[model samples]
Target: MKAFAQVFACLFCIALAGVSVAQDAASSTLTDAEQAFVDQMTESVLVGQFSVDGRSDRAPKPERYSIQSVTKTSDDNWIVQARITYGKYDLPVPVPVQVIWAGDTPVLQVTDLKIPLMGEGFTARVMFYKDRYAGSWYHGKVGGHMWGSIERQSPDEGSKTPESESSESDE
Candidate 1:
């Protein structure tokens, strides 16, 4: 009877440890403020202008980005799925960026982020606040500034479908 009691006590401790591990895993999700930021950014549109280096004389045209989703993988990292329209090309890319906070503001930072067919020198540090975002971008030797407002898209605003996924725009 003494040996049986020892074995049962050991088994009970092991079960408690397993439950603790499971609870820890369940608590690894983002906090409330982080979730709020993610909710505001998802399914939003960024409308802005970008300029190339040494081209200050030309007027900056309109640039548009459709933010499809934002998924938080960890406390400070997130993956953003976006459709970027440049000139006549529409590129859908998954951008992994780091989120840092300055007081109550959230900033998205990307360092040397490479996009397929868009080269490997892309870098951006953008801050989002009050429905607005402003940032600077670098592409190899050419660098520029971008600032825009976030517009939430309604369900009837012609969002991109899965069948419309392509490297080039249909228009």
Candidate 2:
């Protein structure tokens, strides 16, 4: 009976230690302010302009990106679930990116990150400030610049189409 009780105590201590490690691991990666910024940016839309390299004659129009969520995985990495629409292609994907902090500002850095269905050689370094964002993107041999304003979708606005959102921004 004494030996059995000793073994049970050792196992209990190990289980408690495991729980402590798991709790530490579950702690957030972002600071209070940084997490606040991320919370505000999520479930928002980015209205911006994207110009393809060597496409100088193309008219500049606003583009829309629907951000669903942003989850911090590590000290410098986050997973962003967003819907991106370009030309005839629309894709909703989760993109893992690195976040670099300049004071309180957060900049998302992607180096040669590839989306599964999308073409490879895709890279972007985007910075978010207040309600605005600007970035540069590279796709294979083509690259361009993009910047936009972050807009929160109203309850009614969420069900509306992107076209309607674009028009609302115009107004």
Task: Using TM-score, give the best candidate's number.
Answer: 2
Clashes of each: 0, 0
What candidate 2 gets wrong by more than 4 Å, as runs, is 1-29, 84-92, 156-171
Global lDDT of each candidate: 0.55, 0.57
Q: Write the per-residue lDDT of candidate 2 for residues 23-88, one digit (tens) a residue.
A: 235346557866666666667666677666677888644555666666666667666666544334
Model 1 lDDT per residue over 94-128, tens place: 66677788777778877776655545655667788
Error of 2 at 137 (Å): 0.7
